[model samples]
Target: MKLTHWWPTALNPISNVAFLRPIDGGMKLAMLFQLAIAASAFSLHAIAAARPNIVLIYVDDLGFGDVSCNGAKAISTPNVDRLAARGLRFTDGHCTSATCTPSRYGMLTGEYPWRKKGTGVLPGDAGLIIEPGRATLASILQQSGYRTGVIGKWHLGLGDGTLNWNGKIAPGPLEIGFDECFLIPATGDRVPCVYVENHHVFGLDPNDPIQVDYKNPVGTEPTGREHPELLKMKLTHGHDFTIVNGISRIGYMSGGKSARWVDEDMADVITHRAVDFMERNQAQPFFLYFAYHDIHVPRVPHARFAGKSGMGPRGDAILEMDWCTGQVLDALERLQLTEKTLVIFTSDNGPVLDDGYVDDAVEKLGSHQPSGPYKGGKYSLYEGGTRVPFLVSWPGRIRAGESSALVCQIDFLASLGALTGTDLSQIKTAGDSQNVLPALLGESQIGRQELVEQGGGNQLALRSGNWKFLPAFAPKNAPAKARPLELFDLNQDPGETTNLASQYPERVNEMRQRLEQIQKNP
Candidate 1:
């Protein structure tokens, strides 16, 4: 009997066995009935086992309107466009925070980064932020038998307090749940400036160990500040401390010459690792967080992509990132994993031009708007800072369309947990990660009822439907900046230019109390 048609036959097994007992009367009828039930159960198990592999393509500092599908016309992002066209593109999706570290923490842990202290942008040497053995995205998926890995840009920090760069690095990604990890310790503009595979630095020569210090400069390396003539890229501000590969960085490092990664080859290198992960785990259900460092600070595209975009290094880097995305897409197609995989493409935060670099991003920008119609960028408490492009595609599983649901990156833990049949309630501590799986699967238009967005300085904003409230709060240790309580009806004023707090005092009060209540909770 066919397995698809065996379920109904197996449901009435006793009756069939009884009916056939009088006629042909043998143990064969009973055996057939058992076979049907066994086949049906096995079929169901097989269907459940065929969980789609997940690939989350996380880009660093890509804005809402950075791709053509999101209204960017100056430069084309064909690969990103293909992913968007094949999936559900979100119009109102957002990252949990407007920066890398906090957004990553919230996205993986399912908790508000602000709920925990010391989640701000971390230096390359900072201790591990996600407490070990915590219920994390990787842990949950790993429990469900999915091979998990995070490749590129892990700004969540590494090791416990005093990390020796040459020694084994623990309590990092592997401790958190990932089976394999290849990381740039912090951001591209920060230091130690080396690629880390598992625990040790990738290419460290034992003869000349490695040393990192955030406070003072170390070794005899030339810096953009001390040796201006030796620099290939000019520093605008804070990133002039330690120089590696002709670019000054935030912290200081010495030795590990062979391990230092080239800025221009970053895209290609990370792409290769991501593809390798996919190919290696092609037969198993794997979860890959393929984070890209392209289009971030020190926008240095590979030589082949140089001058391709008329805008400048920024635009050229975007094109280079698009090509990297194409490489992954092609890999999936070649491996025949396209239909068997769920791919999500999104950015860590909004866009910013002239972010401590003189890359001509501000001067060469023409009619292109990075944040689309929203206001502010990166560090500001504005829609453009937190709101980003979010797309989810799973062939034959999720229908393709544009969704206006208010979704967030923080929901991924619960959402994916639900997908893989994990009992989330038992795990308990998944702070604020709601299972909006229906909305994520393109089955419902509804998403989160409310969300909290954090900007640069632990400053927070609340979103409820079309209304957004930004309650005035004094800065922690700094002098007051005379900021007023603000409100905006996002449906009417998508730009957030007009503050209607004076008009609707009651709504502001209600949202403020609700925001305070959330913040006050354990």
Candidate 2:
């Protein structure tokens, strides 16, 4: 179950998992026996040994220029910048999709999100999107002897259709590879705004069942559309539903008042549960997917962080996120897992302002560009919609530096396989996860040759080295494209301002041909 409160700094303790030992008699025999057992139990955990503790710090809707090291001059992200200071900071990292759901699907499954029929941004009450028997990154890591856990935003989907909130939420994260899950059903702007831990909603009163819907309202719960006066933050578009904590959400949820999560304490609540999971499983190597929900919609920063960023709710939420990162880093140090753990810092997609609420994101945006001078925000088919900050730090193995490696989030599974010394050939669907371990370790700059990028739905862009080609999507029911044919040399125009498809017809044709071949073949 999820924790009810945030851990105060005063209560946080230092870790004692030290390798330093003295030349004592009782300890000597114990050490020899322990070493023999460790050697026998596939314990390849020394330097250059088996897999390191993998922590994927996947933040939500964080922009490419959000960190201080990444041209975020308007706001500061010292904690994240410190991570960059200690590890390899990637300049050209991109997510598989421009939005949340599909990108997460690709990241976890190593398969293109569009391949699955209904894999788009899902409603909070939508049924499970993943096939029950599918193998995900978590399942793969599980087989590699890593205890897996996912904490925070799980917008993928929930129970297998006909979700009875009072019953077991099956076909959820547990069915996906996460040993345990402490998650939000969807975004903060969605309904049934409660923490689902493992199977049931934490703190849920069995007496108070939750009724949710997207089409019609629950018939009785007063909604934002009907009562605008109840709202604390006004919605500029969409997002006008049952109001909770004076914020209107996308879906309507009734009852379960005790179970509903407090938005103000969400970051802290999730962090405490994550650290607890780490502490509980510290004896063995574990994989923690610490998905932060900060910097998303309904940008309500905790009281302390409210005025921290001059850039309105967006900036304040980023400040909250930076603090969250610092807290997680502190957890690792306190647990004495700093040297043994490898933290991968990245985002699900690029940033977007006014996603749903009028939180002064656009008005208070100032000269601070969230997309870092890239061309798009949220749904655009441009570099800014996908290119984001990526960092890898493992106090010892990875040296401090910057890498221009053209890597995608989908490659993480394969890199972990190599790090754990696991046989990838034994795992199916992991074929899309190419081993970019060398790139991740700052050892090599060579990355995948071709990568498939999705905009909203079925909108595809093929990136081969420096040239990116956006072919006319011809599928009958595909999302409409604004441009017929577009091409750019990212090396020349990383902002994607100039289209070179007409200038370099031969390169365009070559890239189009290659894209079709990979799609048809893969």
Candidate 3:
């Protein structure tokens, strides 16, 4: 039970309720006794034998074309690229959902986010998405004796349906599985724009109470919709609420000025917290989910990386993320935990420039293709929306190779569970997850036989072997049109430019029937 705030000097501090004493001559002995007991209990709960450390580096809105390792030439990502060179690069890896909140739910629970109602895109004040009694990846990993911690983004709701910014919010990340947590309440562009460590909001000023609303403004905070002159980045759509760091966000907010995070230092802050958490738990097998808030909206890069990218704020933020990766890697090497640790790098969804801000992601584009020849961007049913750069590195443990295996990010929980000798007996929805450990290690080039995909736009596609089947459904968020039933041989045309529906009616009907069967189960 080690817990502490952003204290770099002290490093890992033991978390105990006994530290509440004012003056105690026998506190040291009591503390030591408690520590020993906790160690024993934690160890007993964990699996026998030493399990390899797990680190899942999740990035925000990073597309297949964002990383140098994934056919990206315009930007530099030496650290991520080098890691890809050391292990397996999964070209066909995908998140369950094409949006943030849903993808996170699927990734953590191994269940489709759509199964939970209204989990498409969560507002900051939304309640905890996962039920309180559910079994999460963090919970399972904790049972397997891993010290779990989550740093950065936590879009999965917190507290009950009603969250009070001033009061204590219970049953959050710590209750779910993470032994320790430092997180952004929801997003950099959302309301209650502050950080939370454990159960309390960090650096909250008592005199100045916090306030937030999405439907109606509090009439106190500056907004981009009415006060355009106060903003640095202009708005395009939904993100025209309260302004912070000269950028307007999605919802309204006020108070907690001192506690508000600096937009430019967001990357460094999250990276440092992750590195620090790893350093603290290096002695034990640990699971650190370092979710980076990069390449998302309000793309504010630090001064050093501000103009490094010619493609505008989106590209600039990516460079900053690359730098953060380098920093995390450097820390891992410095602590000598690289070989013993497992690193899985991936993105929540694909890319979308000009999502809401006027960061020049659309206007400044020259020859850069964010989706890499793919049809659609974020919030679409096209391959580019969910397909992203998925890489796993374990130094000498995993072989270095590029695999076109059809593995989903949701499979990681089961795959890693197998690595730690865990049986999914305690986990209820183990039905959705498949163990692909061999595929992840590059020992098997082939992966799942049939994988389903969700475009955040509400379109569904199924991939079985080399063929992809998309039934007759018009594209959402676009004009009405009767789309023909489609089936394409992906092996022949990876770009999915041509629809072979009319040519292969039999295959389309076969796949459509199979999809009905899979969807019917559970």
For candidate 3, lDDT tens digit of each residue in 328-378? 788889989888888999999988887877788988777777777666767
lDDT tens digits by residue: candidate 2, 273-292 = 88998899888989999999
Ranking by TM-score: 1, 2, 3
Stretch of 10 with least lDDT, candidate 2:
7-16
TM-score of each: 0.90, 0.89, 0.89
Looking at candidate 1, the ten consecutive residues that score lowest on lDDT are 9-18
Tens-place lDDT digits, model 1, residues 296-346: 998999999999988899999999989988998999999999999999999
Best by TM-score: 1
User: Clashing pairs in model 1?
Assistant: none
Candidate 1 vs. true structure, TM-score: 0.90
lDDT of each: 0.86, 0.82, 0.80
CA-RMSD of model 1: 10.0
371 Cα displacement, candidate 2 (Å): 1.3
Question: Judged by lDDT relative to the true structure, which candidate is superior, 1 or 3?
Answer: 1
